[model samples]
Target: MKLAYIVALAAGLAAVAPASAETLLRIGYPGTGLDDRPFGYGDYIAIGHVKQLVEAEFKDQPDVKVTWTFFRGAGPALNESLAAGQLDFAAGLGDLPAIVGRSRGLATEFLASAGSHDPLYLAVPPNSSIHSVEDLRDHKVAQFRGTNLQIATDRVLEAHGLSEKNIRFVSLDSNAATAALVSGNVDASFGGSEYLDLAKHGVVKIIYSTKNDNPTLGRNSGLYVTADFEKAHPDYTAKVVEAFVKAAHFGADEANRQDVFEIWAKSGLPAESFATDFKDERLAHRLSPVVDDYIVARYKDQAERAKAYGLIKKDVDIDSWFNTKYLKQALTDQKLEHYWPTFDAKGQKLTDGEVEQTRAATN
Candidate 1:
């Protein structure tokens, strides 16, 4: 009878062990990983990393483990991991590649808009005679083909009545393009805030930027989770969103602006670079997670543009691509429902009721 009791206790212990096993939450970000610091470009996820927000969210559940992987290959490489079921969540995915991934049948749901209306600039050799976008006709222009920078470059060219056909397009990553620009290997290159440093040092000259131009020409980024993960762990997904929203709240506050700039400077760029890039731009507007009419219209337009540019083979249904349930619940749970303003499709502010109507339609 004692032996029978011992066997039964062993079985009960085995069952309880499985329940206490660790649950791994794998997250991916498309940026160069810095030792002892997460990639910080005024993004909420980066802030979350600094503050241990996600880990804090799961602190009560000791069996949960949150792991993050940074990819230097950017969105395309991150998508490959997502496709292989290696990543449960991904952030900093630009408009074009995210659309391409969805069009190719990757089962991921958009969680929230990361950053939008980020200006892109065209940089040429400091000594070069290229003074404007129109001067690049028949010249070699280095562009990163598979990223949102490609779309920004295309739109800038179109705005100047020029196309890729007008230039000899060279495919290169941002670092490579920057090197090429400094060495005069490419007549000009298009990129983001890094170019500000190059210009400051006389290595490159900024000919044009999308700051006050067509907002569509600028870049937008977002965060996403695998559909399977979201479906299987809705409560966990909610917690993740809550953590990110909490970070967003901190990132958007005016009091944290200086600290954000200082933290992001750890990515090897000077604090002045972030300040110059974000000049005259509201931090809250850039870091907002709200899926308003502007977010929907911008992504829908990106899909149509990508299709027109022959970048993607099929149309992407932007409406079904998003899972706003998590974000809505996060806002309510965090009491940040009215923290950020809503914008229309044209980037204009909307009344509170209009914002509610938009949220209602999505819900």
Candidate 2:
């Protein structure tokens, strides 16, 4: 009986082994930590990922197979995969790395903003003498380079009348940075809300956070799809964006605040950490998926700054890189045109009247 069952199983495997008619859709995201956590947070994509919305969208198509990949090396690793033509789409990519990749001639289109105004936290050893941003001068600081965090760190330093030259910048990823901080090997490290859990345990003290500071000092990340995939499968592209837009609506609803955090907790971050990081901020502000004027301007500024900082060799034409047709169509189809507020180039919220006018004009 065992031998017969084995033979049947083998036959079944062989039947599906030749999947010549299958279409594989590959999605990539930069993952942090040494454990290579299979999830992510701080955006509507987290909610979408946890809910498996993308998979559900294509469930009826038996020929389609969707796969998600998380790289432990972070944004740079995502770029490497893109260069190798491995990913069809990449969500939750930071502005800086995206710009670097585009400058390097990666043929892609910015689909939608995944999350914006994500605060940056500067952590120091407990009982350290650093009292403010100015105190960072001449101190050994650990920062994750080639990611969105790098630009935010530079913006914060510039705000405090300091630059990268003012401190000893040590390049380290999240896990290494945390380990160095705990061992007193680095005076401070700039990172995301994951540090809050450490602060809760008295493992590190947060000296500065940009949650309530200048919004521009905060980081922005978004979704992107390769031009090749988008051109080849426009229908799949539309369906994927619509799925994410649906998830964004759910995440942005005030009534779903607790539910949103619970979903994000799947990323291995405590729910309370997200709660603390977004304490005063509204979900609608952070979770909007629209590629609005402010987001475009921010990308332009990031590109110019990246060029000035020698992070990229040449200019990236932001206007030509963004393709918002899918996002617009998704919003219109979902009847969510005016659901989220729009901000100006300076990050100030537009008045209701202005928002209405913009919506009308777009329609």
Candidate 3:
């Protein structure tokens, strides 16, 4: 009877092995220290809480384990990790990496926006008189290549009839670029809402918003997954989306405003000014698994623009480039049923209770 029981247990274990064998939650995000400190390399993993959230969602499931890696900045570290197969999914990718990844057969898939809620803006030194992309010609510019921010930068330049050759492009990371601009190393750099912190300190000011150039700049900064782990363990990808959706909601809270500041502050981020004035749902959530129709149309249009402007290998169908299947599935399974309602950035409000209520209702 004991032998029979052992054999039955062996059969049960075998049944579980296959599913568990291919499961790993290898998420990638900006590198930072624990408690959200920056200089993520050799120290902390940015967006680490996503791991905690995913684990909580599958706490009792023995087959799942989470491992997160950080790319020092969005451009180099993120791109390298994905290229090396050390990363299964990552965020902070620019249009170049996404386009180059597909061109180079990197087996990557565009996932969703980092905020899907909103995007960063083009910024310059607070004291600088420059106000438009057209003004940057013959001046030095700082950027981290392979970032979506670069896409924004390019678009801003193109609108003003400028190209890479028209300006001096200096490669620099976010922190480095910010420091460079402050010290006058470069005339200007692409700024996000994060730049508000420096602007408050009187070091920088937004020259223009990417929103001023294209509304879909929101699609420029986003999260994406590699084809390997995504195909091998699709369910795990779904779990990742669910976790981000949760974080996005959590980030929307006015109560978490301080906590959010602390998170970035820990990472040496300067979100203080932005957070201080950030009182809108626009920056809070972009919970859509479906591409906006305008953005969908622009997929191909942007590719053509990239090619015409000499930014990509060739014009590729943007629809073919995106893979939102997991996001759609995650939204369905998590029972998330609403798209982020459009908000007026100019006249936004935040009710803490409303934030909690909406978060609870959605997630």
Candidate 4:
């Protein structure tokens, strides 16, 4: 009779336990600031981190602890952590590294588009003679290899009737590349908005940039979760997406434009740089978290480019890798399905009527 009572009590405890109860959640970002600064840049994920959205989301669950890891080696280093099962989720994962990881048998799912249309620039020494992409040929050029920036740089070079073979390519991360450009160690450096600060300080000249240029030339990154983690704790995954989507809403609001910039500035870039980078652009469009047609098409294109550029050996199937059910549910739960506009494959905004149709279809 005593044994029976103990068994009944044990079963009752098990029944009351939360199905998705986790002791800890580990989140990672590919790029860290100088000296491995805890914060990072380039996406809503960074803004969310600064705002402690994920922490607040799990505040009620005292047992659930959230920790973030910022990788100084950038995307490639972040990929290493994910492969070793050291990380559960990756925020602001670049397209190229994610594609390469997927092709190389990293079991992960693309959760949501973290950032898109982030402009690229080519910075030369303050008094350098190089003024065009064509001039970059036969000159030393530096970029972070195995990153989304690499692919964008390749496309830009190809557009100018050149390729990596046509120039001296030096593989360096953003900080190193910026230092090289400023010290004239590299003839030019190609990177994202962070370079604008250098130009503002009269240290570098921005001869070419994707700003107001081809929208397709812009780089893309996204939130990604390892398959093992998602399979084990689906509820935790949903809660994370919901929190990040909330961050997206905060970032997309025009009223919070300056506030959003301030949050991003924590990554070591000045707030004025973000303001200048996003000038004359719609916050909602730039900060939208939805994985709509344009994002899918861009990833698909990125995969193709990766394969063609010899960056990956195997082909990555976009449909199989992209899991957006959580994002849709998050949108519906947050009543934000109609808040952010969806774009077509060519980066054109869909009409309001078409937006409704897209939401219904996803539903």
Candidate 5:
């Protein structure tokens, strides 16, 4: 009865209908194992959760239906989809990709970060000479041009007194670069923590990770959507945002960590360490809904450092990229205005575990 009622409510949420609004949302899921299609088992579950929550919240209306589009990774392919006007909500992207899309007039906006943690893992082939972040001074390093890795790689270089010209900056996608590193085609490769599984399996070793010294460089993965898309489908956008905000809570809790980890593990990752490595001390406190002032301040810092490091165009303004209306609306509607740690820290974790009170309206 509950499921049927909920399903009926989310019927026509696209434009708003008597029953519900009808929406055609094209979401990009990182295609991996479990679901050969981008909407794998986990993603399908997330989408279903979004649908259920939205439906449950607005049961009075029942006519919104969602469509989806999936991608392999966060690079050229996803960018192409955004350019073609076929995407509404996409996650797991980096700041570099966000910058390039905007530079090319992609009409996209950066929503709240998925969770602040975009550490660049500097990897080198085992049995090679480079053992420290500074060891690659005279050697060439590869990066995914116009991606988030570029910003991180550039920052590391600038801090070490090395520039792009000092060592070759080969532009390649994640797989290509990983392949290059494996075949000794490049001295080092810059990738995200998502690649940690590769390191665990001895595919490569992390000589320097963004987590090494600079903690702030590892901000949350970018969450964004096209401006036109947002405007065209505000309710759909609202629902999508709500799903992610809630998932942050679900993904962080110790009890639910395994479920989320299983989702990540299916993509060739280990569940335990992936959960452990993501459990940050301070930043985890301001995970969803309420965007801590520090998180915003950090974005400013990263943007400045990235420009100084020559990873992004100086003209890109970080402040202008974010839109908090949806986040605000999601929190207000759900009544989740309080701070919740994105991860669990044992006894210190929230009790009752409800991040905030989200009661329905009283008659």
Candidate 6:
């Protein structure tokens, strides 16, 4: 009887083997530059790729393969692919596109915040008279629409009592915008750290930047997974989250700071650019995976701004969009729940002593 029972179990295991023989996790990102490399500035997903962390997590399962797809057209193109069921996971999706995707009925769960508080710069021709955001009025301004930067551009314009219609807006990717700026085709271009290099080379001058402006205008990035994918493969989703969190820990380590910057410099930008970008900032706070109050409030604000700018048809319920379970579980499983400090809705970090006091008071 025992032999018969063992035989039955063996047959059942064999029957299930083929069903789990193959699993595919398709992760999509916005920039095409990072496609050929394993890392990019401030990109934890790329770090995971460089470390082969995700692949190693599933190494024992020979059937699972992880594929990364990069879309040069940025968020809109990535959303199109997501709509077509071509991507199961996404990282580096900006707040605008993420909200827009949800408004358009793309069911995806926000996994964790990726890059946030990225300063933006408006680069004008080396000899141009443009001196500020207000100076760009009635001028040709290059902006990459349908991405987080678009939202930032709009906010910056509004701050200066201007709107997109007030200026001649030209939609161009980062590279094209840079070329146009240098060639005098566009009056100014809104960009990130790359613009710093242009400024250094005397090709462009930075008229305005978010260095001391409102933090909300800084573009935020997030990681997400399709609702169907999450429901169908919760285990795989959890593993992916673990891998990302592991990468984040590595990125936040002070000892690995220079190495992280070196890996990210493969995108053709100098390592010094990243160093300047992250100057005076803590990597742990910047690369935190915790879904703190600040992240929630920021997304809510971005959704509202998107509606005000006519980027979305209706309001997106930001609260319901987040699936913090994956990140929370990953932190707990990795024993890193308290490794990073938590920030308030205003982006102020609570001191460790303060956190303990708060917990004590609540208890």
Q: Pick the candidate with the highest TM-score.
A: 2
Q: How many residue pairs of model 3 clash at the backbone? A: 11
Better of 2 and 4 by TM-score: 2
Model 2: per-residue lDDT, tens digit, 220-287?
99899999999999999998999999999888876688899888788778889888987877788889
How does each model score on lDDT?
0.83, 0.88, 0.60, 0.87, 0.60, 0.83
lDDT string, candidate 5, 234-282, tens digits: 7777877787766655544444545665665555446654564565522
C-alpha RMSD values across all candidates: 5.1, 5.8, 6.8, 5.5, 9.8, 6.0
Using alpha carbons, what is the TM-score of model 2? 0.91
- How does candidate 1 fare on TM-score? 0.89
Scored by lDDT, the top model is: 2
Q: Which ten residues in a row have the lowest lDDT in candidate 2?
A: 351-360
Between candidates 2 and 6, name the one with more favorable lDDT. Answer: 2
Clashes of each: 0, 0, 11, 0, 23, 0
Q: Write the per-residue lDDT of candidate 6 for residues 1-363, one digit (tens) a residue.
A: 999999999999898778666778898888755333433466677678778898888998888999888777879989999999999998878888989999999999999988777788888988898888888889998999999999888888998899998999899987788889999999999988877766777878888878678755677889999999999999999999999999888887766889888877777777787787777766665676777887898899889989988889898988899998999999889888887777677766655422234444766
Off by over 4 Å in 4: 1-22, 352-363
> In candidate 2, which residue ranges exceed 4 Å CA deviation?
1-20, 351-363
Q: Which stretches of candidate 3 lie over 4 Å from their true place?
A: 1-23, 30-51, 211-214, 217-219, 252-261, 276-281, 284-290, 342-363
Per-model TM values vs. the true structure: 0.89, 0.91, 0.75, 0.90, 0.73, 0.88
Q: Where does candidate 6 stray beyond 4 Å?
A: 1-20, 34-39, 351-363
Q: Which window of 10 residues has the lowest lDDT sum in candidate 6?
A: 351-360
Candidate 5 residue spans exceeding 4 A from truth: 1-22, 29-63, 201-203, 272-276, 279-290, 301-314, 341-363
For model 3, the local distance difference test gives: 0.60
lDDT tens digits, residue span 237-295, model 1? 99988999988888887668888888777777778887888888767767778888888
Query: Over the stretch 252-277, how does candidate 4's per-residue lDDT look in tens digits?
Result: 86678899888878888898988888
